[model samples]
Target: MKKINRREVLKKGVTLGIATTGLTGLMRGRAQPKKLRIGFIALTDCAPAVMAQELGLFKKYGLEVEVAKEASWATTRDHLLSGEITAAHCLFGMPFSVYTGIGGPAGRVLPIAMVFNNNGQAITLSSQDFGGKVGFKDLEGAGKAILAKKKEGKPLTFAMTFPGGTHDLWLRYWLGACGVSPASDVRVIVIPPPQMVANMSVGNMDGFCVGEPWNGVAVKQGIGFTTVASQDIWKHHPEKALVFNNEFFRANPEESQALTKAILEACKWLDNVANRRTAARVIGQRQYVNADPDVIDARLQGVYELGGGLGRRNYTDDYMLFHRGGQTNFPRKSHAIWFLAQYRRWGMLKEKPDYEKIAEAILAQDFYASVAKELKIPLPKDDMQPLGGFIDGVTFDPKDPEGSIKKYKVREL
Candidate 1:
């Protein structure tokens, strides 16, 4: 990796890194770039980028920004690759998938920052099958319910936003816990979040794992009921991030760091409870999620509605996290390890990899740490280590990663 001379960067107000060799360095150092083009699909998860742009966070951080509303995740990925957009509010697994040549680009893709962790995401089941809410206080019960459904000679068809995305992993993990082999027992398909309700209503799918707004719409329309929340499946898992092409980072290191700082500031602003209402309103506008503020606000403020009529008025206090005092964006190697383990377990990665090396190469924890320090955010001595129960009834920790992967009885890689 090329190193940026901090003193020189500070003096010049522009990146003079390894990529800017000779003539290019001499020519471009005279002026700063005017605008940063950011691409985003219209989803509630893209709120931070919207908020950052609306609240002047980008401008406050010395950036001229263009917020490009994209039509699809594929379009956003393409824009990033073609240098049409500087960065994107992208799927968490997108960079990984691209880096490993599993999706999108056939080469490496890098993400500058993780946007948020754990939000209003859920797996919803069609109400055509069950008129009332189905009870599943435990993973065993959920599993049995799926088995019973399968035994009825009708297999469950589920949808996720993108293959290898957070929704995909959560849906797979939840199903795998229920003893339903995602590959065999259930037909898993990739459907954009906005189209989930239409697909379910059209009978193309029986259920779907998706982010908010769509889930809320499905419930409000009485089409389906949410079976479980993502938190219930795996609490506080990393969800989405600001993804970029690796070449973009190589060509613009200073711009990359500046972008990270701008985003980090934006995250802090969003987490302020006082600003949440405004954040919701801004994100709910047509330019962003293009949904009702009430629907968006319900989930943003911890008011959850599990379809078929379930949930407290204010269910979870911290459903979506921005920055947990440096806990939010810093890419922990262990977190990357967990994702890799899941990939292997789900057959996305066909082999047990050199987890440490992959984690180090792709996660960019060191870059995140440096940016955090530059912004004066309090850095945690170690990444978060939470002891929690997974839907599969398996326990996990950083120390016993292999054991954790092996403990899942229903894992089907």
Candidate 2:
């Protein structure tokens, strides 16, 4: 609740020996970091930033950090542009959109590191539209029912978090793939993740997509059911990352690296499978998601509860492990490319972007690679290349994106 400058925190902490001056001095000399100001939304995925600071990970690296809770993604992006905050726990394709100028205007945002992957994100459907299936039992079947209702002159209404965030894309992609045109066949609306359940209760939206504790809240309220997960759509799909303005990273390279190192360390702790329950409790605290431990704990450990008889069980690839023995946080170039292609597929990008050039500019693979090497983490065979794959039977190749774009059975942007 109290707002203070990053330097002030450092100044106060250093004098009291709460945090060493050595780390601060190193960063100041390296990046001339005036202050390590970072912002985050109230999502569980933003845990690393909170955990890092709370658990002394940042102090260990000599970071005088200012953690601010942002109200919305648009506000967060604006703060990043004006330098109000140095960085943020941001949406996956956010930096790419900022660079391409699609979401707001290109060339305004840059990503420093992918902090985590495969966290809590889901597609929820209202009880009216639940129809008794759970956990992607029949995406096609759901789409067909919605479409049939539309043809009878009743188009199903759906909701997503933001215009360009992953929830929007996933909801659109899933609906489009099921022979339903998201833009045409169904009315896709924008609702904040926190408001998803309340909006569903109004009988306005037949389904919605958002990240957790929101999804779990819907299931608990008995207003909606978990129909699909972002990870389920594409196993191990990239979720959230640490994004910043390019100017920040360019100006404070060492500080950026230091922050990345600190976050990676926090990630390692969170991914230790054994630490899942503890991480959940920490995140569920008022500083982060502010939800009950039960809601936060289950999904963080990949244990799922489907309200509509999909049954309860553990998902092997639900949440991402960013720092587990160093496998979790590697910012692979393929990850960035996949997001770009998805942006193009959704009409966020009009042209067939220069894949390699775009990937190099937005994704900090070189930076990540150096840090990984320094820590003795093995690099993937190809760092700046694309990796192709099939999602729900649709093949996507980053190399031949133009063809891949055309091959999509759904609507093309």
Candidate 3:
């Protein structure tokens, strides 16, 4: 995709004939919404959807965006499939799961339009059980202890927001790295992100993997301590994305590109660290994340005061990036391949599916590229990268996805 020069438009100063820029054409073709609804869950990463509506970016792009606060990931998936919501702030893996029939029926194709944010999620472990004994640094020991605890009659349970979602993969990988099988050594359950802390408080789950500020909230409530930040597992990892129903994506290219542009603008605004305090306060209202703005902002700014006597650490370098100069929004095919390989590794797939073909279908590169071209944002030179940056000293080569899967000794397949 050719990266247009915004400076040329600026250099022209809206002169008569020179004013018809690509962005102007994008702005001219306004999308008419009969009932365009967008859904979001209550997590810090939902800021993109919130900001897009609040900051008038959707309006700026001539789109009508109705924001729906979904009860859970499953609800979001249902709305997307039924066409109740046109788009959503959704788990990057949910669409893949649904498409591959991992946790739900197939046929609904939810394509990822733009990634919302990355690296603000974490795994919270019960303080009474895993506070100091098992932390991020001692995962090898944590694996052994978790297995030992499970062997004491009652099987220890771990919770994630959705089946075959990013949180599930992270939790399973952490457990596997610690030399424990998520399926055999312990019980893994699906719970919504907002309910993670409450369930833990009632001793329903020994640990959970979820997005902030729940992890921060759990620490403050003295219920659990953050064992590890998701970024610690994989730095700047893609978490959530703007997902739209397949029909909406393929049928209405103009509307889709307009929506993507609006979201891209919102993402740019969100990355401006200076606006986050206010952003947190806005999204923290009763209709949104519904947590204290202070708690949300703390993690939003990469400050962590881990409870259970665990010290605080700052992760500004890798914490919750919404737009890394458009890199964050550019969905990578390699990331999708990794997630697919993970599904295969865990036996979520009966047999290996066409990983690249599915990834290509899921990532709406056309819409994203059009918006990037309109916005003059440069695309990444390469689609695949040597995805490393893991807590385990391992790297996933996108070229050889099967090899990457086999490298894991604790996998089901």
The prediction achieving the highest TM-score against the true structure is 3
lDDT of each: 0.71, 0.71, 0.84
Better of 2 and 3 by lDDT: 3
Cα shift from native, residue 19, model 3 (Å): 16
Instruction: Give the TM-score (vs. native) of candidate 3.
Output: 0.93
Candidate 1 lands at a TM-score of: 0.87
Error of 3 at 210 (Å): 0.5
**Model 2 lDDT per residue over 227-317, tens place:** 8777767665667788877787888778887787667766766676665665566667766677777887788777778677676757775
Q: Quote each prediction's TM-score.
A: 0.87, 0.87, 0.93
Clashing pairs in 1: 143-178
- Tens-digit lDDT track of model 1 for 1-413: 12222343335443211111122332343225569898887677777777667655566555788888987676777788888888888877777766665666544556645555555688888888654536533456566666777898887788887777788889998888777799878788888777888889989988888888788778888898777778778777778888776677777766776666667766776676666666667677776777777877777777767666555435555577777676777777667767767788888878667767666677766777776766667676665364465655566765566667787877766
Worst 10 residues of 2 by lDDT: 13-22
Candidate order by TM-score, decreasing, is: 3, 2, 1
Cα deviation of 136, candidate 2, in Å: 3.4
Clashes of 1: 1
